[model samples]
Target: MSDVVLGVDIGTSSSKGVLVDPAGKVLASETREHHVDRPHPGWVEMDGGIWWEEFAAISRALVHDGDNVTAVGVSGMGPCVLLTDDGGEPLRPAILYGVDTRATAEIAELTRRFGGDEAILDRCGSALSTQAVGPKLAWVDGHEPDAMAKARRLFMPSSWLVYRLTGSYVLDHHSASQCTPLYDTDARQWYEPWAGDIAPHLDLPPLVWPTDIAGNVTAEAADETGLPEGIPVIAGTIDAWSEAVSVDAQNPGDLMLMYGTTMFLVHTVEQRVSTANLWGTNGAFEGTRSLAGGMATSGGITGWLKELFGSADYPELLLEAGQSGPGAQGLLMLPYFAGERTPIADPDARGVVAGLTLSHGRGDIYRAALEATALGVRHNIESMEAAGGSIERIVAVGGGTQGDLWTQIVSDITGREQLVPSKTIGASYGAAYLAGRAADASCAADAPTGSSVPYAASGPGVDIATWNPPSHTVTPNPGLRQDYDELYDLYRQLYPNTQAVQHTLARRQHRLSNATDTRSTA
Candidate 1:
């Protein structure tokens, strides 16, 4: 009787595996790091082979003591577009989620051909943008046709891992929605008519809920992953959605705010929503709807600052930020470090730091970064609210929420209370819970047990007692709120103000990067 369950998370920077018991307790875990190749500026490619290799290494590590694993679940970064042949061999490196933005031309073409702005929104629930799989598929068709021709199937990050595990090609509904013109959330099926015309060469897999049974793990996968040959595999979802599951984001207005390589918010709504500022779609849970917003940079901005200053001690920096007073003394940063995605949907949106002066030090800058991310969150919350999604409470999860300053900043900016999960490892834990449910219904059968261990002041990974409320709740200060209201107005305008400049710079940077790559190959 194998009782242990395994959850594998394929992230932007690394792959993590966690083994857990029925009660949401992590027994053992493993991680394997991987790298992305910047073949050209504005493009990010990672070897799918590296993903599988790392998963194998971590699987061996996770089961070193030989626990009885009943089922395995896989989750990964969202909206990633991968090209693979019928037999599941990679034709080209994966164009990862949010980071790569070389699909501007395709987006324009899509907008022109699909319909005017209003019609496009009505059909796909989002305007054509780099985040949409339709545009990325168009990019491959126009520039990388050989890869596209060879591709008999396309998989998002999570779907790719599940395919390797079960030899079944499937995507959860949440990920499928990002395919934009290809998926119809209302119909709950692939929109073959539009898909055939728009992306005729692309192959889309079957859509299912995140917890649906994809298939039994194959013998080959078992040999590679050190698991039993016939374990059941679930159709896991985008990392953010899985994280929502981990936190029990089930109510009508519950929002899951994930701060990882990017800052993504998924709000569960009782009814369908359509908005110009946010992407709305069917949730992974059956019969539910969702509104999603993403900012292309969150921890990426913080990581950039760390690299610029050459420091590995970020926790200490957070402590230093705690010493600084609110608003970072009027130092406001717009964290568009990786360009903007939601609301404005401008791939060329750039980062901005206003009100910087000689008096400000590293702590002020760090605090400003946190404030910028929170402002982005506030923007998303407003968009969702405008689109008719009620946001009564927010559940904060992911690597970024470990910082008390970050969580409080979001709480203050959004002007809503935040509930930080006791276990911040949202996706990994959600995958584990899926596996546990697959093993036997009795294991954490209730969706979102609301049984969480609260985060202490230490950080994301630090342990604290379960059943406790959030360490501290932040209410928006009226004075700072007035100032931020003004700052956010300026933050909203930054994109339009700099769009033309950013476009020119992005093109130049792309050309230079392509020339360098060509020279290297020569």
Candidate 2:
């Protein structure tokens, strides 16, 4: 029987699973697509039950006859707030990451309570932003006290899966580090005093590294998923970090650029680094750290254009966008349709199409949207560098990287070469690789000393380079550098110049939404 590891990742839009042999070959893969619920203007959520249901479905579909499933690995979109009771039942739909801006008031209150922005940044490695989990918890405490009172524990998708599969409630260090004001990056542990003050009634899980074995799959999970009992299950992390590990981008000086619904940039650094514009968190692996940045929307904006334009598919749009050329035919877009995340962290920011005219077609608008995301990438790269992150190499991953135009645009806008890996399956593949590592370690531990078995003789570890190598590189076009540089300046200035108007519009939109909700409820 061939030894295979199973990996499953719950994402913002879908859940994906993969079965990989010891040699890094994917034997089978499965995906289950789902949508998030937008209950309010800035609220994005999904039912926590969907994660395990999709996992079981994908697991059963991937595991077949003659394939011996050795271990399990998991990853998910986080750092989400999935408060649950002591029995692990969710109190409400999981509040998503930075994209969900419903916690702004809580963020402001927490920042003030924590002694201002500088003190929080110095202690927690990040200020109280929509991304931080503590503020989201506080939002729940203030808004839904009944639910908050019943909440006995906290769990993200990854940790929730770990607990369901192995009956162990634990969170990886990388995920915990994002729970700002609760996890101390300097101490690499939960700050009990702050946690007590914020979520005094809740019980925090034990911490583990992403690669650490949380526990073994129990008989119940094995029965449901058609896997053997007692297989080791790793305590996985957030999807972006797993995506980084998928491409060997966890080393210092390497940046993993994830082209997805939201553009995410993870720059691995050797030591703790913090800045007002970027996030500082523990690396996916132990003994390392990372500076990260994310934009609120990237492919999301393009998708919106596709729907608005009534396009049958993306290839046609890409071809037309290509013809529209570098300057996007005199159109510029802010790409803030869902509000901005890193560098700006402004939830009130609104999308702007500055140069649009009657002559502009759908193709020109599409090209501008693409360029807008590329410009956003460049902005984040600059911010990461300004925060002392060195980007010696950029590894591109995710579904958006499948197309050439997007990657080329990013390379041209950022003036950097991007390495596209052989497997862009993203986080599911990375989780499988981690599972393979854990399984190999278990084999080595049980094997006799100096045994001739392959697991023991060849060393029980998985190398990411062996799993996924760079298939090609996208180099920037030097001729367009001067033009893009000038456009980037305009892109930066457009936000500040239009900030007050955008804020006022945002407030008006909020009031209208509230009125609509009140009418509906009545």
Candidate 3:
């Protein structure tokens, strides 16, 4: 009977679970695919119940082998707003992170109320934007009062799992920091005045480090998941941070590039840093900070393309994309299908494909999409460096990293090397490591007699270097740099040139939707 830790992650398109031994070898893994609901444009949501259901399913499957499960770790896509009643029942489907731009008006109102963007950034380490939980909370309060009235607690995917597993209403410091205006980066606590103003009726969870032991799983949770009672559960953070941990990218000067439904970049910095273009917040572990940026779409664009192409798998598309080469056969695309996020933050922004021709095929279009995301990565890297982040190392993670073509395109476009780790199971693996650290006897013994123990001891903990190391590096091809530079310049120009038309079209779309709703009601 080998001791194992179970890590589960609630992702945008799926829930993943991994079972790992203390030595970091994966014993079992499971994934349950799911999709978010888009009832209205810019509105992305998932039923909170789905998270728990998937978690239980994944857990049962993973634990079926009778591996002695020692601890439980959890992570999820976030800074989401899952408003729950006092008893922890969800009031509405959880509003997802950045991709859901339904709170644009609420963002503007909060920014104005809080003395503008700069002040909010200075105080909260982030400006009011789609990524901020406060705006989403305010949006609910304004638009759905019935749901708001029932909401008395806030839960992100990670926190929701923690609450269900341990019966502890706790949020990790990293996740809490993203609840901009409500969390003070300097004070490292919930800013009461701002929190009261924004979410007046709800009780914010107690803050804890992602590694801290949230609580032990009770008998009820054990029965549902086939896990032993009293297994320690960690206060896991967002999926991106967990992915960073999985790749050993938590150190200063390490930038993690996550390629998923949305592309995300997290640059760990030594001290607190703020940027109007990017998000600055507390890191997963204590005494660390991160500057983060996310593009609204990346793999999402490719997924759309796959569906549009009809019955073509990714390998077939990748082969075609490879043949299309450096400039995607003169096509340029803006990877803003879901609207841009970091460095742009334009919710009204729409996708644009330039240089289309009758000669172009599906391969060329797919190649253009890959190049578009690569260019977006370069844009974020430049912005990050401008904001005092030093990106000495680049680590790539997530589903998009599985293919070589995309990674090579990114490396060539950015003129940087990316280290792809061996175990790209991502956040679930990181959660398991965190749980293993929490279950370490040394971590428990070092704490003060009655004080809550830190999830990690005051040293190099959970040796990620050995657990997951770089399998290979993607190096840029020097010959393509000049051509990419020229195309990059064109890519930069295309957005501003078409901004007005895109805005008008977006407004028209809203108008048409509203008219249809009115007609249906009549």
Best by TM-score: 3
- Report the candidate with higher lDDT, 1 versus 3: 3
The deviation in Å at residue 365 for candidate 1 is 1.8
Q: What does candidate 2's lDDT look like per residue over 227-278, in tens digits? A: 7778778889999999999998988999999998899999999788999778
List TM-score per model, in order. Answer: 0.91, 0.97, 0.97
lDDT of 3 by residue, 1-522 (tens): 877889999999999999998778998899999999987778899999999999999999989655888788899999999999999989999999999999999999999999999999999998988999999999999999999988999999998988888799999999999999899998999999999998788989988889877888889999998888877888899999999998999999999999888899999998988988899999998889999999999989999999999999999999999999889899999988888899999998999999999999999999999999999999999999998988999999999999799999999999999999998888999999888777666565233211344534443335778788689999999999999999999999999999999888888977887787788889
Model 3 lDDT, full chain set = 0.90
Sorted on lDDT, highest at the top, how do the candidates line up? 3, 2, 1
Candidate 2's C-alpha runs over 4 A off are 441-461
* Residue 8 C-alpha lDDT in model 2: 96
**Of the pair 1 and 2, which is ahead by lDDT?**
2
Superposed by TM-score, candidate 1 places the C-alpha of residue 397 at a distance from the truth, in angstroms, of: 0.3
Give a tens-digit lDDT track for model 1, residues 249-338. Answer: 656788988888789898988887888778887776677788888988888888778888676478877887777767887788878766
lDDT of each: 0.76, 0.89, 0.90
What is the TM-score (0 to 1) of candidate 2?
0.97
TM-score comparison, 2 vs 3, better candidate? 3
In angstroms, how far off is 428's CA in candidate 2? 0.6
